[model samples]
Target chain A: MLINHPLLGPRDAAEFTCFGDASLLLRPDPGPNGEPDQAAMDAFHDYLHLRDNPAGTHQELWYHEQGDRSWLVVTRDTINHSIIKVELARNVKARNLKTREGAG
Target chain B: MRYSVFSILNQALRGNTGWKPVWREPEPRPAYDIIIVGGGGHGLATAYYLSNVYGITNVAVLEKGYLGSGNIGRNTTIIRSNYLLDGNEPFYEMSLKLWEGLEQDFNYNAMVSQRGVLNLYHSDGQRDAYARRGNAMILNGADAELIDQDRVRAMYPFLDFDNGRFPIQGGLLQRRGGSVRHDGVAWGYARGADSRGVDIIQHCEVQGFIMEGGTCVGVETSRGPIRANRVGVAAAGSSSRVMEQAGMRLPIESHVLQAFVSEGLKPIIPGVITYGAGHFYISQSDKGGLVFGGDIDGYNSYAQRGNLPILEHVCEGGMALMPAIGKARMVRSWGGIMDMSMDGSPIIDRTPIDGLYLNAGWCYGGFKATPASGYCFAHLLATGEPHDNAAAYRLDRFRSGAVIDEKGSGAQPNLH
Candidate 1:
């Protein structure tokens, strides 16, 4: 699979280290409760371990280990192994954080 | 009908018309005492044990496709209990013992062969690790033997012993570990369960779970809504999707694992052999085809197919282990979806929803763990308590920091 890295252009999938499901980026925060309550702990556990492993359109994390030291979020259809979108994980994380902050 | 020589002779005399269907193709009942989604080997075995052992006969096993159409029939068919962890060794050893008596118990010719399984080591460190694993297996009342390169050469001299990259040093052998007819396991369990008055419903796709308050009462299937006092889900690859209908996310990812078979050849491989340097494992089937497989496709996917890169990687491991098999033509290849968990172990515990039990996260080891997985899952469903052998397979173990990390890969499902 040719994953078009955000920084390094198109690179073979062999050059990237595959970490499954870009949902992993949405880590649950330790809320303002001084100490984490039971609900926060459960939310954190789900954030860290739970996943939506769909057969079609999935966003996953891939690190360009051999090409460049950048983590890329690639949206691909797992059924036919087709790439749909590619972006820097840092940028995606920042954009998501900004959106959440703006909403808050 | 009892399948004996006399029955065969009687059927032969009567022009073979006395034989009956192995299992009834029943329609889904409106209600059942228990409903088991996914009629694969594990689900069928669970039904069999529930009816026979626990006397819970009012069970229905719903299948989306035909029996054994999932990973149960798609694996390499090797069975071994050579594990290093206290959490896995006893369970798999129980499975191996159950496999030994499976045909007798079910009255079917499932062909459970106990030709030894050997995991070769290429380095001294790897050998040490295998030694530790063998000791653990022995401590768990399972048989394990450590042998040097000479003994391996005596067993199979065709291996690439002199290869500088991964020279064969030693191996750990489990004498009782071997292969079984993969499809026969499902059929045997189905027949056994059917005889015990459990309904085996094929082509019944489960659409969603029926939740009453906080308890799972039944399922919405393609046939219609079927009520049940308890619901057990043994869906292999679609565990995440099926559980999601109940608004429960799983600590599991689905990945594709491919297996291959070569054209028929003379008897070459005497027993199952695993390459230590890489992930390839191979054994000669009864039909003379060399069945083999390697690692999973290094990505999360529910697709039941793999990429060419993993196929080439598996072939490279095969060539590195046995150079003679390089000339063998690959006749067929297929993929099975693996329900990989965070800690490389399984979960056979009650979910947060009352009366909802889960038996998933088998990953690549599901085929070998079939019998014991069914036994423990049935025990849990019958008594509402985790079986002693499967007490470590709690769903909240990840949160409790009590993960049974067999591979020690640290929360990486694909790596496991």
Candidate 2:
């Protein structure tokens, strides 16, 4: 499998390592002081454990370990392994944070 | 009729024409006392034990396809109880015990070969870890022996003992651990359940759960809606998709695990041997093919096929361990989806939904845990209590901060 890297064209998937679901980017916050409450604990548990392992399309995190050392959010089909889009995880995180702030 | 030496001789004398079908093709009934989703090994075994041990004969096993089409036949059929954690060792030991007498108990030739399983240690640190693991297995009433380098060489001298990178230091051996005919297990259990008046319904895909108020009462299948007093889902790889219809999320990711088989050779490998440095394990089947596999594809996939990267990676591991395998040509390779659970351990417990039970998260280890998984799931479904051996496999354990992480990978499904 070849993952199209945003920085360097398409690269062999062996050069990159996968970290499963892209939801790991949205890690739950414990608190301002890093001391978690009961709700925070539950949020952290679900954040780390539960997954929407869909059968069709999936957005996942992939690291260009052997090349650029950049994390990329790759939207791909789980059934056929066809990559639809790839972007830097930093941009995706920024966009998500902006969307969350806009919602509030 | 009961299969025996007399039966074989009687059939042989009559020109071998009077053998009946092992299981019947039964249509779905409107309702049953219990409904088991997924007619894989664990599902069939659950139905068999429910009727044989628990005497609950009003059961129906619904299959999306033909039986044994899942990981039950896809795994590199090795079974062992060499575990370090308390939560896992006892449960797998129970499975090993069940495997010991499975063929006779099911009255079928499952070919349960107790030729032993060896996990080779490559370095001093790995040897120490194996020693600790072997001790834990011994404490759990399972046999484990930490053998020296000389003993390992004596048993299998073809190993790359002098290789600079991964010199064989020693190994942890489970004398009773070995392989079984994988599909025979499914057939045996299906036949056993069918003889007990349980219906084996094939091509009956469960589309969704029939929820009456807050409790699950039945399932809508490809055939029709069937009601049940209780429902147990033993779906291995499709656990996430199957349970999603019931409005539940599991701590599982489906990944494709591929297995390979080489062309027929003479009887070489005596038992199962695992490469400690890499994720490769191999055994010689009775048909003389070398059966082997490595890690999952490391990505979530419901595709029952894998990519070339993992296949090449598995061959590299095999070549690194046994260089002689490089000369053999790989004949066939296939993939099965694995329900990889966070913390690398399985969950066999009641779901939040009432009257609905789950037996999933076997990951790639589902093949070895088939018997105990079924027995424990059956026990839970019948008595509404977790089996003593499986008490630690609760779904709420994750929420309570008590995950049974055998690999200590910390919520990473693929790493396990």
Q: What TM-score would you give candidate 2 relative to the actual structure?
A: 0.97
Q: Which candidate ranks first by lDDT, i.e. highest?
A: 2
For candidate 2, write residues B1-416 as lDDT tens digits: 89999999999999999999989998898999899999999999999999999999999999999999888878888899988899999999999999999988999999999999999999999999999999999999999999999999998899888878999898999999999999999999999999999999999999999999889999999998999989999999899999999988899989889999999999999989999999999999999999999888888888889989889889989988999999999999999998988877888898999989999988888888999999999999899999999999988887887988788663353354
Instruction: Tell me the deviation in Å of residue B329 in model 1.
Output: 0.9
Q: Which pairs of residues have clashing backbones in candidate 2?
A: none
Model 2 CA lDDT for position B200: 96
Best by DockQ: 2
Evaluated on CA atoms against the true complex, candidate 2 attains a DockQ of 0.70
lDDT of 1 by residue, A21-63 (tens): 8978878778666578888888888888888777789998998
Second chain TM-score for model 2: 0.98
Candidate 1 residue spans exceeding 4 A from truth: A7-9, A33-35, B410-416
Error of 2 at A82 (Å): 1.2
